[model samples]
Target: MKTAIVGAGAMGQLFGARLQLAGTDVVFLDTNQATIDVLNARGVTLQTESRTEHTPARAARASELDETFDLFIIFTKGFHTQAAVASIAHLIGAESCGLTLQNGLGNAERLQEYFGPSKTLLGVTDFPADLSAPGMVSSNSRGKVRLGALGNVPRLPNIAQLLDSADLHAAVEQDIRIPVWEKVAFNAALNTLSAVTGLTVGGIGADPHARGLVASVLEETLAVAGRLQIDVSRQRIEAALDNAFAHHTHHKTSMLMDREAGRPTEIDTIGGAVVRLGQDNGVSTPVLATLCELVRTAARPGDNR
Candidate 1:
């Protein structure tokens, strides 16, 4: 099956390279001229803990694709989701499945609006990726991805088969909402804390103040989740938090990286989501609310610059 990877940045290129190495016809789509030029000139460069490799594939602007795709894996940044998908919606056919593995919440709902709920697949990945340069992705950590339908979509089997064929370790879940919420809650807790505190994942875990802050934010988010009947348990979120800090401690979060690079942070999607949901659910999330403001304030005109 022919598959297209939307937003061929770090995580996208990592998946594209792996799938191509497993002998899949993977095409990469990105708007960055440098990224496209680099990939077109050489290939996708993947660097893991063990080794590095370059996978060859067709590179094009999303608008340049003339034929319909069987599947489209979207890995765009959270803020760019709508515009990114809009650029390539014409390439999606009736038989195509669109999987969004983006960070934060509301992404599946956004895709549903564009591609119809029946054609959407929700996915999440723990892979730590960074675009060290154009066409070069620093895949410093090996991670797993979970993918499934959100509302009884008809294309999961076909999507799963294609992913499995590409050795992507894909699975069809009975309920994906729980996992999605769980991931969002965890990101709400740690992502902003790392961004504001300027700490590594390990640093957040080790520092008593940071750990306390994470627990407070997560506890408040769980309260909101409970109000929504989402079952985001403190025990589960805490365990996942610990696992994330332990496993990815050396790595910097995307938020932290963004702050370092003087780019807009995803606080509006992650922690800001909790604050918005809490207000809507009538659940108070003081910690998360405060962090949201702090991160936004710090991301001002010349702070990170």
Candidate 2:
């Protein structure tokens, strides 16, 4: 299949490289000129604990994609989702599948707004990767992604087959919204804390105060989920937290990487989403609200304080 991976950041490059290495024809669509140039010239390079491989795939700015794709994977930052969709809409044929493995909520809805709801496939991944440079990615671990049609799409089997063909384990889920929220809740607990504190997952769990902060965030998130009738529990949230700390003990979250790179963080998508829900439901989320404020303040261009 002729696949196009939009966003072409760390996660996009990582997955694109993997599919290309597996002999699938894939290209990366990104807005960053330098990164696109490097990718088109040198190909996508990735180093994982198990192996290192570089695939010579095409790369182009989002505007340069003139050919239709069988699969168009959306991996852009949440804030950039709308723009990416607008730019790539021409390349999305009716037969193409739009899969969003982005980090937080609202992305699926945004995608559905552009492509028909039937063409949208929402999914989540726990793959941990860091983009160390243009055309280079460090995939610290191999993780699986769960994908499902958002609203009765007919391409579930085809999408699953493609993933299986590429040796990726993607399961069909009828009720994926729950797990998406679960993952979002889990990320809300740790990602913002790690970003604000500049600490690793293990580092946060090791500190008494940091651990307490994460627990507080999780508690508020669970309360919000309860109001939304999602059947989320503190036990489930804590268990996921424990698993994250155990598997990616020393990893820094994407939020922290954004902070380090002087890029805008996904505070709006993760923590900020929680804050909005709290306000809508009249639920109190002082801890999450405060954290969101601090992160936004830091991400501001001129605030330079």
What's the CA RMSD of model 2 in angstroms? 2.4
137-211: candidate 2 lDDT, tens digit per residue? 887555777888668988877887777666466777767877788898888878888878889998987889998
Q: What tens-digit string does per-residue lDDT give for candidate 1 at 163-226?
A: 6666566777677767788888888877899888899999999999998998898788788778
Q: Model 2: how far is 296 from its true place, Å?
A: 1.5
User: Candidate 2 — which pairs collide?
Assistant: none
Error of 2 at 129 (Å): 1.8
Count clashes in each candidate, considering only residues at least 3 apart in sequence or on different chains: 1, 0
How do the predictions measure up, each by TM-score? 0.92, 0.91
What TM-score number comes out for model 1? 0.92
Which candidate number maximizes lDDT? 2
